[model samples]
Target: MTRHPTEHPQFYLTAPAACPYLEGKQERKVFTHLIGKHAPTLNDVLTHGGFRRSQNIAYRPACEDCRACVSVRVCVAEFKWTKSLKRQWKLGQDILGARLPTSPSSEQYDLFKSYLATRHENGGMTDMSVLDYAMMIEDTHVDTMVLEYRSKGPDSFITGIGQGPLLGVALTDQLCDGLSMVYSFYDPDFDGIGLGTYMILDHIVRAQKLGLPYVYLGYWVDGSPKMTYKVRFKPQEHLGPDGWAKVD
Candidate 1:
């Protein structure tokens, strides 16, 4: 059934489960479905309010006693390329990323499997089958796209597409004010090349070119080494009680 764009959506909370970022603690989330004609607008609003999209649901951490997860977004207009970031950018100069419609391909699934095996073997998504991966990419109502990165080929300048094996992929959403990075993974063999950071930097540039002012980086949890990288982007804003405030 279709709902009005201004209609208040019902929110549900998930039961507490083992916290992925913090060991020995539990985490819960408040989520709502993104569907119908208003899904895109609703996604924009929820994203600005600190929620992140996964599949057709928008959610945020609602842990009882922990507030470690802070939503962050890069202030793209004010972002400066540091020397280190410049080096990383040069390292990935041969790679070209293209934004494609939210569709699944066997090649993407193969890369996803390899990424999970090498980087997150013991994580929750390690056992995901091809069907599950397809659903993750296709079961979306908002303006979602997959940014596929590959080595620039001979025809890249003409066709705007690379012609080699996929090196990285980012599931992203385009909102009214920014580009939200839902999830991203890269080839583990290219770990030292910093493909993950390269993707974020690329997104910031993409956002700036589109006249967008932000690039949402999802939740950056304190004390989580894995999540620490999210803070590397300077002049970022963190969602707080007073809404998005500059993080120094």
Candidate 2:
């Protein structure tokens, strides 16, 4: 049976740009648009092949003379919480992630802006306006969700919603095999809770509850300090020339 044109994604290479993860290095990417009824299927396949989703686009590094970007996914069923991980988890026990729609809001944008200002002032996303942030959350064709992390309220047990100021946000994608953490941000002032690491632990538990075996954590650049946290989620698999293989 011949596949439809949309099912056979056409990829395009990006123009070289300064690498975000490495100094004095350039980066290029090969990307394909995800659309139509087959978008979810294409997302799953491309993700397993080391591609990452950004809106309707699925892309992977196509840089010349570079192989630092490695796709990582936590093995949900095999994950064992470390003492530090457990401490991080307990720190956020008063909060929970509430699944919301793809719609963006002023509150969420406020938190996003603050996070960018504090944690990534000199980074690429620092100039994103509120509209740009909205597009990032709303411009999607595949399965996606906005997980709002907030303080648990009195009626949380019944309504399953949280109250108080938003502490963090996770833009996640539910794929055929697992939840892909497309993006996440938190209030930098609210330190000591380890919100970033706590969010990943939540995703791992969520994946297990849903019977998903993996939690895609996107690319883990070998030498990038920003990516070092990814490897701590042990019992993970890294995509390679051969295929997915366990990496410690």
Candidate 3:
């Protein structure tokens, strides 16, 4: 049975929890399930309205007293590579990223565990098990892909695929106007390679090739060092009460 895109979804609000980005603040989220035949279209519409996808759910910040988590999207047509970004891009030249079906693998889960232990040991995802990681990758109802970055192999030039160890992974959603990056993690040992930044740059290039206008970067908090990186991409638009407004 086909579901109509015009059908309204039932939204729910999450209980207040400690804010991850801001200290001493509580955070809440208003979310709805993304499922059925209209999932892709609904995901696109909700994303345009500042919602982000996670597994089978679409959510946006609904904090009581704070609006720090602002949705940001890179203007692909206007993005320019700075010297630092160019260097970062070059640094990852030995890495090959390929978009694959959202299938869970023990290899990817191992990498995820290592990344959380090294980078986000104290975060909410620290306790995630292999099953949990699998759910994160496979529970999506909308159009999704897992981009796996690995060290380039000898046959990479001919096959156009990476080999050996996984360097990074990005769980992304395909939207009508852009690619929404759901979550990304990298091998902490390659921190100097700036895998995270390189992934974003690659996404922008991919978006440009596909003639997409934006690359949804989830949210950017003003004072959160963890999220400050999102702002470095120039010509980005931030969602506000007036809708998406261009940020200098």
- Which regions of candidate 2 are displaced past 4 Å? 1-4
Q: What is the lDDT of residue 86 in candidate 3?
A: 91
**Of the candidates shown, which would achieve the greatest TM-score relative to the real structure?**
2
Clashing pairs in 1: none
Model 3, span 110-148: residue lDDT tens: 888999999888999998988899999999888899999
lDDT of 2 by residue, 103-141 (tens): 999999999999999988899999899899999999988
lDDT of 1 by residue, 1-248 (tens): 96574367899999999998889999999999998888899999999999999898999999999999999999999997899999999998899999898888988888888888987888999889989999999999888889999999999999888878889899999999999999898887875589999999999999999999999999999999989898889999999988889984
| lDDT minimum window of 10 residues, candidate 2 | 1-10
- TM-scores of the candidates in the order shown: 0.96, 0.97, 0.96
lDDT score, candidate 1? 0.91
What lDDT would each prediction earn against the true structure?
Answer: 0.91, 0.93, 0.91
Q: In model 2, what lDDT does residue 186 have? A: 93
In every candidate, how many clashes are there? 0, 0, 0
